[model samples]
Target: MMDQPATSRTIDTQCVVAGSGPGGLMLGLLLARAGVDVTVVEKHADFLRDFRGDTVHPSTLDIIDQLGLLEELLKVPHTQAPRLHAEIGGRDVTIADFSRLPTKCRFIAFMPQWDFLDFLAREARKLPNFHIVMSAEVTDLIEDGGRIAGLVARTPDGSVEIRAPLVVGADGRNSVVRAKAGLEVESFGAPSDVLWMKLSHQPDDPPYTMGHGGPRQGFVMVDRGDYWQCGYVVRKGSFAEVKEKGIEAFREAVAAVSPLPADRVGEIRSWDEVHLLSIRIDRLKSWWRPGLLCIGDAAHAMSPIGGFGVNLAIQDAVAAANILSVPLREDRLADRYLAAVEKRRAFPTKATQKLQLMMQSSSKKRQESATKRSGPPSFVRGIARWPFLAHLTGRLVGLGIRSEKVNMAALKAR
Candidate 1:
């Protein structure tokens, strides 16, 4: 809703963020903190519904701590996912141990995505510069002279046109802003589909475990407190077939792979509790236009293997905010904002895509070999066994792997 009288002022110096998910809302919060007039438009009216992608990784925990949100986040009902145990070659190996991480808060927090988003939204509302327009859908981007300047939205009452100096596309994989900007996304690898369902917490539930079946390549992350998020490997477009087989068959498949008891699986009944996500890694050659920039799932969509979507989205928000803080205060800041955002996000996007490919490899032999390993792979285990190797491996996989260096470099550059 418009805060001021329509006759008194025009909608100038606006920031149109298309999605009000974690990425968009976080961006809104950061921009609003920087004294930017931000308007976040979300299609959803409330944040009570269930959604996929719940695991908050350790890297994001560090950022949350830096933002002074770590304590508040811990106050929420969440399970500390300390260990990432995977069944490789029928042998369990702990790949990521949060307790060993350097950060004070080391564990990956297992909380519903909606809860996290709701927390962020509550914090963002405390800032006067932030305005959230829920139940409003962005129909299209308003372009002026080959540059993105604003967006046209269909609100509850009527059409609202918000003209801004910069438009950030934080919408999910299917981004309206990306389409309007005519950005070309370079498709990297094959699509990996996941059929995910959650089960109710039972008294007899097994100990917290993370399971990965070799042949099926399915994974299950059991929360420490209650509920289990189960994901199955399926064909790229076979969600309907899996659903057609009925919930009983699905439960059997999950029980056979996961460490949890079969009876616990019976708690799931409705299709509403289950969701199918088609995952892919897409990188745009350019993440900027004349007056707009894309971040999070809008610019790069990585495979969901490492549970990195939400973390990467938040990281992207940090980068974009840091880059735009200075430029956004100027009269013509769109160009510099876009360039800086792209520079900050480029390496991270590429590194994440590479990791996605490593996880998505469908080679049965590789899966079997990985599953057969007694502990973390020889290369990884060798390091864990020795203090030096452990530190080295930790540095390589935990921090040095992928885009951490690049992200840190970007932050330093800013």
Candidate 2:
């Protein structure tokens, strides 16, 4: 009988990316497009989870445009927010105007994160070398001679060990890959957490996507076609207290901060409908080890103030892929190369975190003075009145401090 080719049970690739979030998925897609065999391991069965980062900033859309996927991706359901408004005290102030941004897509695209991930996955699969292993969770590092050779992941069949020269940890803030690699993070505790709830959309609600804050209560409402996705900002570690107070009290508090129709606030009738995200402003002091690299929230956790998390993650992926793709493909990547990724991204990460901390402090002060009744503060009016300040604020919220560009040459198929 002719010798039969043995069925290979082990999955091998040039790179094993942990977490299928924006950063991980982008890096995987970019690397695969460059003809590198890459595999992404996702802990979840699918990207259908709720309350993920849904704001796709202009910078990220530019990346999609660069890759020629923007038009197709936009076909998915989404809304464009060209301006950000905040009803402070009782005055309506424009906080950010994306119309002033230079990018082709000047507005923030609000789409469910799952749709974004699905778009990337679908695009990546068009390339023959890309692979995604869903429902596979990374459990430990596969060490060989004191280097992070690869990782051990628990999958459906059993424990599966993947060995590769490079293991990218895009897992997230609480990252198993980062933990296994022993990366230390410096946390600047957040003053507030967010309670995510939705209210039914009404025709009478203000047309502008806006934030509303009155004394201690702050919430943001974004138009999602038929509904209002509301974020109720509360003091850090207050979920238990909020819950103990019962759903009606929480509903009234949120209702007070919403710019939407107050009657619709009753839509949030149960605590079950609300999701709590304990905000933390943190970053890894160092973003890499000998054979492992962390990006996105795995390297730096952003506060939800500006909806910058998804954009930052996408930028990190671009920078990392630009720096590491060639070295990884040629089988000559080194720790210094990983160091360069950190060096390139550290400034923006620090700058964003610093701003988030400032916002948190300011919010805490506002909450303490909740009893005061007044009009919008001078700064709020100044931001709306001064064109320069408004433009600067818009750029900061839209493009970030230093936006990253994905090198087309690096991503070109070989």
Candidate 1: stretches off by over 4 Å: 1-10, 87-92, 244-246, 270-272, 362-414
The model with the greatest lDDT is 2
For candidate 1, what is the TM-score?
0.85
Q: What lDDT does model 1 reach?
A: 0.69
What Cα-based lDDT does every candidate model obtain? 0.69, 0.83
Query: Which 10-residue span in candidate 1 carries the lowest summed lDDT?
Result: 405-414
Q: What is the alpha-carbon lDDT of model 2 when measured against the actual structure?
A: 0.83
What is the per-residue lDDT of model 1 for residues 1-414, given as tens digits with 9 covering 90 to 100? 333223322356557788977789888877777767788888667766654567676666676676678899888888875666666555566655556677666666778888888888888888887887777777888888887889877766666777898888988888888987899989875545877777666687545556666354466665636666677766577788878998788777777776666687777776777787787778788988898888888888866655667777877887787777556645448586678778867886777677666555533234456555422224434433443543333333333233331123332332
Model 2 TM-score, all chains together: 0.94
| Model 2 lDDT per residue over 316-409, tens place | 9999899988898888989999999999999999998887777677667666676774333345557767746866777988899899888888
Clashes of 2: 0
Model 2 stretches with alpha carbons more than 4 Å out = 1-9, 371-382, 385-387
